[model samples]
Target: MILIADSGSSKTDWRGIDKDGNVSQFRGVGFNPYYQTPEEMATELNDEFLLKLKEEVVAIYYYGAGCSTPENKKGVATALGNLFGNAKIKIEHDLLAAARATCGHEEGIACILGTGSNSCDYNGDKITDSRPSPGFILGDEGGGTSIGKKFLQDFIHDEMPAVLKEEAADRFQLTAQVIQDNVYRKPFPGRYMASFCRFITEHTSNPYCYLLYYNAFQDFFKKHVTRYSNYDQKKVSFVGSVAFYNSDILRKAAADMQIHVHLILESPIAGLTLYHKDNL
Candidate 1:
């Protein structure tokens, strides 16, 4: 059996395929070497369902966030090795997952717009260029977290329209103290902030909400997409919940920038499943 995983900081989607070509799918908690230890990851994977298939897994392809550095890659590799002792494990950064899932051996620009955002210039099989992703705190333009950050700032400073402000207050009962606690005292603050994206999507008809997403995606294009050589000539594709749910706004932003959007997937798992199946 082959195990393919597309993981973000928030969740992981897993697909298992047996020699007979039958497939199974499951979900698991997200893993990031930056936050969890190898032992912790192993423990998380020790569930009955995962353990039952351990011996059947011949190969494991894990593409995830925080797997960019060698140390981080080793961390996840070690954890997987502990569980699937006989299986070959290949670990890679999530940006490659987006590229593979969206571009599928075609040259294009792939972008991830999830809890965090990233982009890479993919030349068929490998990433040829990429911009620095300073994570969610410093930068992550067009990501849910970034959008939520802007929403919070506007809400707190009374910059949002009065009706939307009242609605936000009524819906979330947010306060400055609550914001500080979530961002500073809680775990996975990026995910916490991204949770508000649902509210933003619900209010897209409002001019304020429309402009918020428009400006955010525009910033993403300027800061990341424009840096690539002749980026306008390449087809742009996206993967992640932010891009999937707000495709209308994303397409508008792309059109405004005169860039063509080729694809937008809520998650890359399905495309990844096909990629792995065909390659195997």
Candidate 2:
């Protein structure tokens, strides 16, 4: 059996491929190496996913956030090996997952847009290179967290029209106290960041959202992928809910920038799982 995992700051997608080549997918909580060490992360996995394990397990490939550093990658692999016992495990950064999904048989740009954001240059089967994934600090331009930050700023600073503001407040059930607690007293700040995605998507077709996508895509392209001018003319794809589900405007924005878009996946976990099954 081969196991593949695509984990982010919000949720982990676990797919198990049996020896018969049957495929099954499972879900677990978020495990970010920036915050959760492998020991801690494996504990969460054990509690949520230990039941899925069997004696016939063979190879495990994990593509996760914050595993870019060699030290972190080795540490995470060790911790997971401890959990999986003698299972052969390979740990890699999430960008590889994005690359394999977006450029399964061709070279292009691939971005993961979930709780955080990252972009990479894929040469068909592997990530030949990637932009600096700056977490949520100066980057994550098109991610759910960024959208949520925009929505909160609009609501908190009275940027929205009076009627829309009232509607949004009523719709999301947000209060000053709730915002304070969620922002400051929360366990996962990224989840709080994700809280604003639905609200922003509610107004996605508006001028505000139109500009938001345009600006964010431009920034992501300029700050990240453009350094590789050789690939500038190729298509760029998006993976995750914000960019995939809201692809109408995102596609237009890319087109406006003369960028061809090849795919928009609600969750690239499907592609990642299939890649592992077929290739690994």
Which residue window of length 10 is worst by lDDT in model 1? 41-50
Query: Which one wins on TM-score?
Result: 1
Candidate 1 lDDT over residue span 1-280, tens digit each: 9999888888888899998878998888888788788898888888776788999999999999889999999999999999999999999999999999899989999999988899999999899999988888889999988999999888888998999988888878888788889989998888888888899999999999988888999999999998998899999999998899999999999998999899999988988889889878
Q: Which sections of candidate 2 miss by over 4 Å?
A: 47-49
| Candidate lDDT values, in order | 0.91, 0.77
lDDT of 2 by residue, 1-280 (tens): 8888888888888888887789877888877777777678767867545545745577889898888998888877877787788689899888888778777888888888777888888778777777777767567877877767776777788886777678777976876667778878977766787767776677766777567656776676667666766655877887887787678877777677677788888777888877777775
Model 1: runs farther than 4 Å from truth?
Answer: none
RMSD of each: 1.4, 2.1
TM-score, cand. 1: 0.95
Candidate 1 clash total?
Answer: 0
